[model samples]
Target: MKARFTPALFAHAEAVLGQLLRFDHPADAVVSRYFREHRQLGHADRAFVAETVFAVLRRGRSIEARCAGQLSDRRRLLATLALVRGWSQRELAPVLKASEEEWLAAAKAMPEAELPPAVRCDLPEWLYARLEQQFGADETLALARAMNQSAPLDLRVNTLKADRETVLAKLAADDITAAPGALSPLAVRLRDKPALAKHPLFLDGAFEVQDEGSQLLGFLLEPKRGEMVVDFCAGAGGKTLLLGALMRNTGRLYAFDVSDKRLVNLKPRLARSGLSNVHPGRIEHERDQKIKRLAGKADRVLVDAPCSGLGTLRRNPDLKWRQNETSVTELTVKQASILEAAATLVRPGGRLVYATCSLLSAENDAIVGAFLDKHPEFTLLPASAVLARQGIACDGDVLRLLPHKHNTDGFFAAALERKA
Candidate 1:
């Protein structure tokens, strides 16, 4: 049967929304299952349905509040389409009942002042409070506004395979537009999202899709050509690949993570990038025997700790609603423990880089501050100096990139060097 605007899309959307709202499944999983069950929807139809449903989820609280507790799944979807998606009643008349016009008018007139801060900012109260604590009134508003926008696609040229200029030229030749990134020499901002999986350059291992902010983390580590380095939380080896490329595939780059699934995912990327130096290790925990064996031996280590993911709102807006105070508190403890354990892998005089895709200072600065207080031998090194030495000029002691300020995911990175 053909799926159309009359009933099919709405039906699938309602089912998808029910699954998303009722259960704790990740948004991607929910969407994937929906697509798998209804494989008849084409790419354009799928995109519309998925994007509309996501917009609703991102602003569910606000939309529900506008409906004044009279919310049904259909009404909520209609409200979301009108308000967030800017669809007029006439535009939706084909799908909505004739009786819904009055309700849509009232929803359209819903005052911003009447809404709670969380609804206004499309964030949870706990998340807003934490950001308020970290950034105060003005900056938090700015950050929230930035997070509401879509994220751009970025690519990191694999120097071991090809230089940035060569890759850029090849990409241009293929009619894929990209420009040099603001900070990292290896980073390039693509004009539009393109599927590069089967592209000649990508297949040849000329580049990898990585955010510029993430690429900066590699620069902060400043791994030497032949020194042993470890990406302590190298999920899917995003930073691990960058570090491996930086080391010119000469040094051993240990990619450690608790997830065997994530390590397994990195294997193909390793082959694509031609990184012969990477060692993907699945650790039982932060204190796994494999990790302990490398204690005080690494020349550089990166702790891209698991975080609230507040900084990645553009890519994963659902996180703002999913994360709560209790969850953040649990993560902070884990982050601190991971940093402590990862620091041990760095030899005296070696560097440990701490990074997270979190806008909250509690996860970034506070975690590092607490770690510094406990470990006397490690001293904070200005991230600017570290990047400058690597020919990447960025300001501030800690490298902070907000979506609004840098047009990248909100990220914080701090470099620490151990004393001899």
Candidate 2:
């Protein structure tokens, strides 16, 4: 006999939750594998299971603590639906037992302060402490709140294919309503999530789903046509495509990454994008001889270094729980090494831009500061001036975006020019 309570879905959720609790693999990877294993789930069912499981992981600590040490997968799921998802007891009753109802009632009455700091903020303690150092009490609270919310899908119209107006018009023709992004000229903020994979415009490469904040990074690079540009950490070529577009497909854009897998993924995107200027290469590591060949040869280099990805909390809430102080410190070392290696690729008079998705000063300001101190040939250029030169007016010497301030992912960028 078929089990009660959406057996297939419940089983999927249970398996996913078990994997998530183990924390051995990325949540997305686990979810993807689950979907691949069970190909029968439709889009809506997949979304529901994925969202529900992520909700539990995002708020697992609080839920587990509320269970009074009697934590089981089923009880946690019921509590997650009730407390985190705000589902009514009657609504959850179908999936839960009468005994579970009493447990939930007791859990509902538990005081908030009794839970751990990680549970309180829905983040790991180490992450909470790190953020606490960067953000004051009120700001930390605000950031945590913002991170808990879902991110809207934003798309950047490939200018080479279509302008914002044309893209918007095309989308409207398909009965999709989109508004201009607050920050990026090429961006369109969709009112709701619409499947665009097979949309004629998307299939024709008119637009790509990218965060507005990320789109701004391409503008910050401001590559001129026919210039030699290098995206030193071009994982999957998200920014590489933008830089290629900015160069108007006339420049030699070298997209370098340490991971061959990421480089392979960029190939299809390159074809769909109609960009002819990009050259994707896999480096053995940052110090590869292939990288040395380009030393002082690039007119522009972007070190979009690997980071903690704290800025993307809205999209990956699980990160706040998975990240810790030790992991961040390790990342800082990698960032410094990558920046040092990438800086060598910039020619005298070239621009080297350092950027990260982290909001922490250690990863942002401190990394740049130490690099500037070690390299006298490189001097800081006002990012505002750089953007202004390109006719893009934004705030100050470094681009700092916050979820609360910019309604986008927290991003930090600084530009340095090699002394002529």
Candidate 3:
């Protein structure tokens, strides 16, 4: 049901937007905190506030361009409603101040074609320039357009607990619409975002809320039933559960991370996943003794190295505003170090997959290229071939899933095998 907006709800949304514009914390965190503080908000009320605030964030640059000298959170919110949400000026008159009427009209009159290219794309100048150089101006704009929109909720079925068909049937019985995802055979794309925290199927761990693109990474590793596998940087054990299920819960799968809190968060999910093969461990750093002991013992290792997270703009638009070029450059250095450390775990003839949820080449292709140059013992495997073996059709030597092309979060993965 559509949330009924009142003057008070608008006040709540405006206050939340004001806080978010500070950009000191993640957008989700800020909104969640606000909701916690204001427990009086109904579910639909919270959803309305969050959706409105995120809409402004996604088109922040564009909305600011229109706001010009009169920039304020309220103005941005008004402009977003009028310009993006298709709210007629007549509909917005209930909350608009006398002075804002003319401003809203003029803001709507601002020609988008006349705005700067970066503003038009709703991206930062440096990010837009880098993307343009890599993908050309037209393609970058297309990518930005895709990223600026809301992302669909994609789920991965845990084969260890339930099959896709059964899960689909259950969702149908519950009146929750979903369909098979185009990319991963185990993927289920939901038609709408629903609160699944209390859903019996989700509580039972029949499936997980994983991006379809991320699910492909497990396919790249292809852990065998008795093989030892490691998910380096397994934040919250999303892929760890996937690898354990892929191995049919018969092999040892280690979930390692630097954050104890993230590993702690995985415990509940791990219990629901019905996987006995996963071992969660916290490490001080990439070169910690825990990782050192596992060197040359893993049959498959997945380094889903942390990056700038620019690829997740559709879900985390705040990141584009929070992350800058310097942060990305710093991340590249750390990514190289982590990839190097993780590669040491792969035994001779074992497979290693280096992946990132980053669109920048420096984090994806460049890191893999430099790794291959330094490590003569590891041969770059054609990602297309490996995915094809599992009935996935990928065209590139590396697996690159773009939001514009694949309707999944942007992802890049390269598969490598150690020479025996």
Candidate with best TM-score: 3
Candidate 1, residue 70: the lDDT equals 57
Worst 10 residues of 3 by lDDT: 66-75
Worst 10 residues of 1 by lDDT: 1-10
Clash counts per candidate, in order, are 0, 0, 0
- Give the candidate number with the greatest lDDT: 3
Question: Can you write out model 1's per-residue Cα lDDT over 1-420, one digit (the tens) per residue?
Answer: 222565677777777777877648678778988898889977666766777778776777777778776577778788888988898877787678878888889878888668777667777788888787777867877787778766788999999889999988988999999999998899989987666789998888888899999899999999989999999999999899999988989989999999989999998889999889999999999999999999999999999999999899887777887888888889999999999999989999999999999988889999999999999999999988888888887898999998888988989999999998
- Tell me the spans in candidate 3 whose CA falls farther than 4 Å from its real position: none
TM-score per model over all chains: 0.93, 0.93, 0.98
Task: Give the range of the ten consecutive residues with the poorest summed lDDT in model 2.
Answer: 1-10
Q: Indicate the TM-score of model 2.
A: 0.93
- lDDT for each of the candidates? 0.86, 0.85, 0.93
lDDT score for residue 47 of model 1: 65
Per-residue accuracy of model 2 over 354-411 as CA lDDT, tens digit each: 9999878889999999999999999998888877776666889899988887788889
lDDT of 3 at 321: 92
